[model samples]
Target: MAVAGVSANRLELLTIADAVAREKNIDKEIVVEAIEEAIQKGAKSRYGAHHDIRAKIDIKSGEMALTRHVTVVADDWQPEDELEEFNDSAMVRLTDASKRDPEAFVGKEYIENLPPFEFGRVQTQMARQVVTGKVRDAERANQYEEFKDRVGEIVNGTVKRVEYGNTVVDLGRGEGIMRRNDSIPREVFNIGDRIRTYIYDVRAEAKGPQVMLSRSHPGFMAKLFAQEVPEVYDGVIEIRAAARDAGSRAKMAVLSNDSSIDPVGACVGMRGSRVQAVVAELQGEKIDIIQWNADEPTFIVNALAPAEVSKVVLDEEADRVEVVVPDEQLSLAIGRRGQNVRLASQLTGWQIDIITESQDSERRQREFSERTALFQEALDVDEVIAQLLVTEGFATVEDLAFVEPYEISDIEGFDEDTAEELQARARDFLDRQAAILDAKRVELGVQDEVMAVPGVTGAIAVALGEGGIKTVEDLADLATDEIRGGYEVKNGERTKVPGVLEAFNLAQEEAEMLILQARVAAGWIDASELPQPPEPEYEEELAEGEYDADAVFAAAPEGDEGEVVDDEVPAGDPDQPENA
Candidate 1:
């Protein structure tokens, strides 16, 4: 297109723009706009700089036009701050504009045609540079918009270059980077090698879109299975969870919507052909396809497949599971370096501890013996009766006292009358224990404010008082960690003592609740209000000089200064002198 007297074939200009847009993978409209802008710059150079010039291109016909624009304003109108940049040539007063066009009115735009310009070497080069830069920016924006929503999907690309163990892949229209850590262990890539990677993230950076790819991400395996397994892709089967050691072994939990179709079998395919394809892509990484279970214990058992679990004891509060397997299955359950159990824990979202049946039996027996002894001593019961109580799952005197009479009577070898008598004795013993704790609390001078805090019973008050936390203020000052485990000094070394929570037989949550309650009772915080987290304390550097105690004390407010000053007395008064 010829613009501002420049001799350029309109068809050639449009052809070049179309080719550049296609080559750069940018929208054609952006290229056209860039060309129009370049022409405008050239036009402005030829015409007066004070004139407002613009250029437009016809996409189909490749025709170019340049026009000068002037805004009509009232004769008395003055330039505001925003319009101050425009010179008189860029604006026309209504009276002056009306001389040329009688219909000209204020707030109307006046357009004037400008002659086409001759193309000079500098102008042509400048236009080309502008077109190149604008095309590049358009390409970047297009790539970002295209790939932003494709994160967590798998894409195929060719390795373009490798820098310091980071492989840059050319994804046809865009580029991606796979860091060394994100690749499978021992996996290597060469230039021009075709590879598939998971688009874990795409960031719009200052330079361009940063597409981060990964081969070791658990999602990568899930995506691969989706490509290989029709059932997963169609949603008949769902992959619940995946955990990978990457190139060594991996675990996947799959569930099926149709109970008739086994999720694991569907993922595995007949004779493991489908799974083998995934394994080959992952460089022979072992894949365990286990059926997912709604029940956590059952899921945990499935996660640790090939290892027979005899029993599972769940600690929901801690989100941990203790799995007991046969003695021979112990090694398999733990796997090499505990990889099996580790992956199982990750897959089930719970901490897994494996023990052999024999070990579990021994531990159970030890606990039973300890509980039997405690019941015998605390409840004044014989060894046989204590054993019976322990066998019935009554581990403490409190259990006997608080349990329903029917539950106590239901225990084998215990009649209704015997159960009632035992319950009465248990209650009497607990009453006596409470009285003793009350006396100890009083002797320790435990404050009623501390005792009144929720979760702080007579026993806990006594423990806190013994630990030198005798008042609500002292208790309130403790952190959650400190309340859960008291600070201790051993062998002149200060350390946090464990089992403080266990000493009160309280859970960690309960210990924190008690600390919050104490803080509220002490007026340090409001009820149902969360305390503000303490800010980090920075040490102040003191100036080198003799310390000025008076300057420091004088700034404190009233009682905070530590000595009361009489308002009636003037400083250095002879009759009434100040007391130090």
Candidate 2:
């Protein structure tokens, strides 16, 4: 009866391991191995801690085997640690083993079978902990493997719990976390409440894989649109861009491959059903469905929907645009708390500045007067001729000085002689300015070598001298940020650091070029080793659509719609103030 009871207990051990393996979704072999380790520990506690004991469980037969092992070592063998030196029952000197066996080798191992013993209270607790920990590690690994590849896909989950403004989601197979900011504003989820979110990122953390979820990510709206719109799912229409203020508002740019279908119409659905479905999901977010245009300016116009844009001035170098709207539409164009323009800017990937038509007109008049005055003073010409030149697109003295004579002569009321006289006077004015700037540079003690850098003009040299950069070496030692003026973080607070030529408003590339040229001139670097400048990006005219302000001006009849026209002010101009 005692032998039968021992057999039953062996089978029961295997049963418990199989049950745990199934419940934890781990390999049965792993469970058995953990049980083996637990048994080894308990045996050590019972058979003296010095013995090298081990345990193994049979896979097919429900039997557990125990063994005590002693390894034969060479005379020169030493213990790995002080603890091992004191616990040397597992090792037998080869010379001593040879006396007992007459053929002992350095690596020979002798094993002894051991009887199973009853588990003490401490032993049972240790065995339970070992099994639980191994199962948990396996579960975490399983969860990570199952969900890591699912990132960027929308998922449905139940709210497991909420802790400190973060919601933990039980994704049937794993768990995901949606932080407070990731959730739509003012939206809340209760325990067991079903919620849908986008898996933006998956990270393997020390405790487990962190599955990050978000309802506010731009991708979330796009994915929701895909689910509701068949064309999007079938790839007939593509969501080009998306921006969201979460629950408040969003703008989505969509394009259709087929010209027959309107991408915006398809996304909006019949009577706004499809969009309404998405809006319901996003807590009534007002969506602007913009029809994507190859022309970035036109796309921006579409992005700022429900608000009329009279004109758009694009500065491609800065990736910025200034939009002129009717005076009455300013509040609507800017939206509630500037949300509309902000979303439009995000959708078009451009920095957008909105202004009333009156404001734009006033600024244009100011620029026109400024340019006319500059031309009048520099060319020593009458106001009428300067006004005519300004009207014909001449904004600077350099424009008149270097222009082909015929171009100016073609202007209304201007002849070849008049153009020549203007050019000569403009050249004289520029020469005088250069002389003055050079005198200032000399007074400031700037070295002549500083002017030798390819891009360094007299004005730049004067500015550099004022900024305490007197030599090419000083300029060479400076970083681009020092010359371009960038933000610095001091004690976690961002502060603007003024550049030596900050007033010049140089482009980042331009500043880098100046630094590289200075370095080459100072013999700090070879001219040939300098990196080539990037090719300028030119905007393509919109596909059978003109999105440029120049196009708008040319198409519209003057004094008909009172449309604001672009003044053709280039960005980074020293005389022009930023629209921002």
Model 1: residue 461 alpha-carbon error in angstroms: 5.2
Q: What is the TM-score of each candidate against the true structure?
A: 0.70, 0.78
* Model 1 lDDT tens row, 232-342: 999999999999999999999888999898777788887778888999999999988787776566677778876777777777666667787889999999999999999
Cα-lDDT of candidate 1: 0.81
Q: Residue 415: error of model 1 in Å?
A: 5.3
Worst 10 residues of 1 by lDDT: 571-580
Quote the lDDT for 477 in model 2. Answer: 94
Against the correct fold, how does model 1 do in TM-score?
0.70
